[model samples]
Target: MATPPKIPGLGAFADHKSGTPRPATPRFVTAAAWFLCLAAVMQFIASVFAIMHSVSPERRAVLEAQHAAMTGNRPSLEALQNIDVITVVLSALVTAGAYALFSIFLVKGRSWARLGAGILVALTFIQLVGVSYPEGFTTLAQVVCGVLAIALCYLPESSKFFATVKSSRS
Candidate 1:
């Protein structure tokens, strides 16, 4: 059989104690990458829904009436506020952009991305632990996103990335 191809920095997987390079990615980072990708896809779908629903005046009216009855207050849809479409689009764009940047950093073994992803996970967890919002799906999504983000940070690939980064700094 032919010999296995050699990676430049990696000495051998068996030599774990040596100063050989392991995979730059840890498990957590891989999870985080998947999580971010999911979030991006969800955001894109939500943006499309928002854009389509924003212009549905009939649907808006029903929602507004329901809101008025539930809250005993004037609904914000009074202006026929299709402006929410913009907000949704902007959110989708921002999330997509963040995902792209995070993916690049993940591939390059950037430690800062790991830290930032951790922080985001914490914040998302807070959303789950905090009071439930009126929207059920939003809460569910937040919990899923948070859990995945945390999982990514804890993975082996992520650990390696962080370790490499620390070693470089020192």
Candidate 2:
């Protein structure tokens, strides 16, 4: 086989035929994409838990007392019972859609996938910050979830996938 000619600075990367830069494939990034999908699943589960778990009677009493103190009268339980289930469902659907988009981008090795995952990680981190300042168990879980999502974003498979995407674009 004839040795391909090398351009001085390009070294082994020099192309003899087209003289254009070629891209190399990344091996690990695709696996990290699963994190986006898993987050959507977890969000759905959290929404379900939020909707199904009733407030404890003690909590309700505390709320009632607070309300009475503020309004000079007890608020009816019926008012509390009027929770908007539709809103929660809609939020879940939106979250699921975002996940689907992210999954598609990840699988296809689109450059946008990295941006999307980064944005998702940032959002999770913001949520964690909000949770942490409050010092509640709920916030702790939020932080854990955020950490997991961020970790997944940096997984070898995900990095490889994104690298392939970057190379392809070049």
TM-score of each: 0.57, 0.53
Give the Cα error of residue 15 in candidate 1, in Å. Answer: 26
Root-mean-square deviation (CA) per prediction? 11.1, 11.5
- Write model 1 residue lDDT over 61-170, tens digit each, in one string: 77677667775556477454645666667866876667656655665566666566566556545645643334335445644864676576656756767677556433
Relative to the unseen true structure, what is the C-alpha lDDT of residue 119 in candidate 1, on a scale of 0 to 100? 63
Which 10-residue window in model 1 sums to the lowest lDDT? 9-18
Q: lDDT score, residue 42, model 1? A: 54
Per-candidate count of clashing residue pairs (backbone under 3 Å): 10, 4
In terms of TM-score, which candidate is strongest? 1
Between which residue pairs do clashes occur in model 1? 25-157, 26-156, 26-157, 26-158, 27-155, 27-156, 27-157, 27-158, 28-152, 28-155
Question: So what's the TM-score on candidate 1?
Answer: 0.57
